[model samples]
Each structure stands twice: as C-alpha cells, then as structure tokens.
Target: MESQPHNDRLWIKLLVLLAYKTATHKHARRLSWSSQTGGVIPISPKLCIKATPFTQLAEANAMRFVAQHTSIPVPMVHCAFEEKGQTYILMERIEGDTLAQVWGQRSDESKARILRQLKGIVEQLRRISAPPSIGVANVDGGPIFDHRLPRKSSWGPFATIQDFHRELRSGIDAGDIEDDASSPGVKDMASFHEQAWQAPVFTHGDLSALNILVRGDEVVGIIDWETAGWYPPYWEYTSAKHTNPRNLWWQEEVDKFIAPMHEALEMEAIRRRFFGDF
Candidate 1:
C-alpha cells in the first residue's frame, strides 16, 4: 500500500492537474519560462505553479524546510509532486517586486533596511541544525543542486568536508601537486583546500538580488530555494560573490550582509581559473 503522504500527494496532483487544465484557457499567465527547465505560471491571483523537468522535488522540500524552521518569508508550498517526467510545485504567489527591480530606485536608507532584514534571515538560516552525519546535502540529505557547478546537475551528499573539497578540486588530491613542477597558484589552491573548515551550516546557496522580494523597505519574501542545502559556512559568502556582470552592484553589497570569506572566495577563483565554468 502507498504511504499516507504519498496518497495525499496523489490527490493533490489530481486536483492540480484539473486546476491547470481549467486555468490554461482563462487565468493562466506565464511568469517565467526556460527551454531547459520548464516555467512558472500563475493560475490565480494568489497561487502559482512551477513546473520543471530539470528541477527535483528537493526545491519544494527546501522551501518547506525553511518555512518550518526559520522566520524567513518564503512562498507557502501547497503541494509538490511528479508526473509525466516533470516536477510541479503548487505555491502561494507572493505580491512584491524582486529586489533587483527596485534596487536602483531605492535610497541608501531603504537599501540598508532591506539588507538588515536579510542579515537577520541569513542568521536564522545558519542557526538551523543539520541532521547527524549530514555533510554537504540538501534539506532531504540528498545530493545538492547548483547551476554554477559543471554540468548543472546534483552533486554528492558527501560524507565529510574533506571529501567535498576533493570533489571541488576535480578529484585531485592535495598531495598530487608537485612542489617543483606545479604552478604557484595550483599549489596555493591545493593547500587552501586541505585546511580544515568549520562544520556545515544551512545555506540558501544562491543569494541573488533577483531572488529577494521586497515591498517598500521590508523583505517580504525570499524565493527560489532550488539551491538551498547544508554547506560550509563560507559557501553562502562565496556564492554571493560569484554573480555575473549584471549583478555586480549586488555582489558589492553581499559582504555588507553576509560575513566576508575572502580566503574562500580567492580559493574559489583559483578553482574556476583552473576549471572554467562549463
């Protein structure tokens, strides 16, 4: 027999399918779409559906986990399920502009207030304890996803930070570096990766301004939890700094909110230099 939760999910899925069919000819509006990952559609004023073939149910699971554990405002997940080779997340549609949209128009005071609220939210996220034996993993203690990583696929729920670092180095051991032959930069990166790090903490993984929703000076919501997971404390800071040219201004503001991890950022730069973002 199917589990109770599975049964409930099936019922929800059926209802969602019906609603989707009905809304298609009337209320549905595509919020965002991608050829690779599917899209988000609003079927009602207060509800939306995010359907994607590339995303796992883990994204919805991460949102629910944050809602349950912290005071951070995130979209309320109505249901998440898989059917016809795609994952669908039915969620509340929050009414607010992404921080990216209003950032340039805001005064310094307004920006500071928003950043303050975000700092508190980040603190709350870090305070959540990871399950025992959890290394680097998603909310469900499974492989974590990141588009920045090569192949844009799920990586390991590594057993240890050292193991995770090894993976980051593309399976190259620190000792594999020849002191006499390897470039100074390569040797530095290998040494940096060998250093011990503090225990993993809950991380939002991607802290882009595009993901932060704001209303006036308040941070009303933080959307896009697809990359959330238990990760090294520096992961948040470094990830925030890894933004593109369009987000350069946001990257400058990152250190003001999250604690700066300069060494980690430098190490990450070295890794990227050796192995360009593919």
Candidate 2:
C-alpha cells in the first residue's frame, strides 16, 4: 500500500504536472520528477523548472550574480516567470553526479581534492563584498532579513548586528526545548548574542553534498541558489553545519571542509536541539 505521505506527494505532483501542462503545453513523456518533493520538476533532459508560490526572483538573480562575480558554477537561468501565483524558473540541467551520489566510492585522495576545491570556492564567495547586513539579499543586492530556521518567512533587513541578534534571541526563547544530554538548551540568548560577527559576506546559504555537482573529480556545478545572500560571516558556516547528513563521514568531517565557525555552529546546534531537528 502507498504510504500517506507518498500519496500526498503524488497528488501534489499531479497538480503540478497539470498546471505545467496547461501553461507550457509540454508532454509528460518528456518530463520527469526530480528527487526533491515539490517545486523542482524536470521538463527535459537538458532543462528543469522550479515552481514556488513565493517569488524566486532573488534565487534567479543570485545565480547570475555568482556566475558573473565568481567562478563558482551555478546553473544558467533560461527563463523566470510568474503564473497562477507561483514563480517558475527554467534553468540548465547540469550534467554531472551530485557529490552525494559518488562520495562513498571516492578514494581519500579524491575526497581531499574535492574538499580543497570547495575551500577555494568558499574563499571566492567570501570575497564578494556587501554593505553590512544580517540576512538574505534582495534583487537590488540589498539586505532582506528573513527567518533562518524552520521557515523562510521574512523578518527584518536589520541595519545593526544588535538587531539581528535580538531577533535570534527571541527565536531561541520561543523555540522548543530538548532533554538530550548532548543537546544543551541555550540558557543565555543575550550573552550568546554578544559575540561579534565579522562584516557581512556573500554566502551560498545552503551547502550540502547533494547540491554540489561533480563530473569525475572536479566540481561541475552548484545548484539551488534560493538561499544565496549577503549575511554575517558566520551565516555560511552555521547554515552549512545545520544539515543532517545521511553519510556519516560527511557529518564527521563537515567542519574540516568549510571555514570553521565553532561558536556559531554551537549556537545553531543548540537551536536545532531546541527545535527537535536532531
């Protein structure tokens, strides 16, 4: 029997398919589903479309900015349009295997090479200067603050770091609590918030193995720029560290792959614990 969630997903897929069909007159025979549950649907071998209720304008712009400013490989955006209250983005389908697909079979040397490449990419991203801010970037390349965890809801494009930390502290206080010993509750959001962040820098915002595309040993593309933004220096590290990896090795050595932000990561870990993400 099909599980409830599976059935729900199928229904949503069907609705999306119908919508796409009506809009584009495309045939399902040429279309396929991506591993992602919603929004992202493959329309052709060399192209895919991502549909979202909220505007994906920021994502589309982010990709262009990254490609232009840095050598980081992001998918080429062919088109972006809004229809029926959803934003649809058609983009190039990168021809490569996701790092997650090949990580386990890779030799230690290959893994190290990939890590080095990623570190270089991170360095490049960090070089993109931005006006001081503590949240996602808008289409104008200005700061647009939004909730960091559990949701993408907008909050404030805070002018000061203090304002950003105040929002974070509030979130911590209202967040759920956990009983695990390894998972500690954040007892002092005020004290925790006192730590100063270096100037804001461009961030990919979500850096998981699955989002990294590799052809053989070289990284060919980095997909999903929806969360790309100008943020506090620690945002990239903490956000990347917020994942729950299926690969144990990834979970173990993630800190080594990217720049280390121990204090920020610890804060995120505590937040995740409170929210039951672990």
Local distance difference test values of all predictions, in order: 0.79, 0.65
Write down the TM-score of every candidate.
0.90, 0.76
Cα lDDT of model 2 by residue, 1-278, tens digit: 11011122444555545656654444334443322424566566787777755445667777877888999988887666544556666678788998878999999999889888888888999988775444434534544533455344554556655565656555543234333466444654345655666666888877878789998889999987776776767877877766544556665656776768787777767655554352
Question: What is candidate 1's lDDT per residue for 105-192, written digit by digit as tens?
Answer: 9999998999999899999999998788888888888888887786547789788778877887788899997545445477787888
Question: Model 2 compared with the native: what TM-score?
Answer: 0.76
Q: Give the range where candidate 2 is weakest over 10 consecutive residues by summed lDDT.
A: 1-10
For model 1, what is the alpha-carbon lDDT of residue 241? 83
* Alpha carbon deviation, residue 119, candidate 1 (Å): 0.7
Question: Quick one: how many clashes does candidate 1 have?
Answer: 0
